[model samples]
Target: MTARRADRAGRALAQGLALALALAVVSPACAAEADPANDYPTEARADYVFACMAANGQTREALHKCACSQDVLATILPYDKYVEAETVLSMRQGVGLTANVFRNAARFDDVVADLRRAQAEAEIRCF
Candidate 1:
């Protein structure tokens, strides 16, 4: 009876450890999924921060504010939509007929407007 009791205890301990290991493996993936802003690539966030710092001034305060702004923007806008707006803006900068198309389209205007709204929100929140 004592030997059987010891065997049961060992089995229980093994089960507990397995459960803990499974949770450890799954927790980070679950967290990443829960966060809407996790879809933004690190490089993209860094680029925004760099541009923001350039505009605001290259100081520690600027770094913090710019990083916060990027986070705020990410929370407000999905990465795909952000990319679409940026592409439209870039096309609008070209000095030709192709640029005119981007500049004149109502569809493009809506896309850029969404980005501008997100940027305004970010600026208000961070700066």
Candidate 2:
């Protein structure tokens, strides 16, 4: 009977340790999810870094600077605003009446301006 009691205690300890380990693994992820300011998805950040590296050069220093730049921009601009600016810029690059609307619209210009301001801030902070 003593041996059986010892085995049950050991099993209980093991279960407690397993629960602790699971909490340790999940807590940081939960904290990150709760952070509202860091709403940019990993893929968006990666895409920005890749484009920045392409434009600035593919060196390790460029990679660091680009990542920093993206972080700064994330702080300065929300992901939805970033998407809006990118869409405007993309539409402006096309050769048609629709592109002209994007190019000439004041709201579109404001969106691009916000992105440019964010980029400028990022450049100052990161590069």
Q: How close is every model to the real structure, measured as TM-score?
A: 0.77, 0.78
Q: Quick one: best TM-score, which candidate? A: 2
Please give, for residues 54-81, the per-residue lDDT of candidate 2 as tens digits: 9999999999999999989988898899
Whole-model Cα lDDT per candidate? 0.95, 0.93
**Collision count for each candidate, in order:** 0, 0
Off by over 4 Å in 2: 1-29
Per-residue lDDT for 66-114 in model 1, tens only? 9999999999999999999999999999999999999999999999999
Model 1 has an lDDT value of 0.95
Candidate closest to the true structure, highest lDDT? 1
Ten-residue region with minimum lDDT total, candidate 2: 28-37
Compute the lDDT of residue 5 as modeled in candidate 1.
100
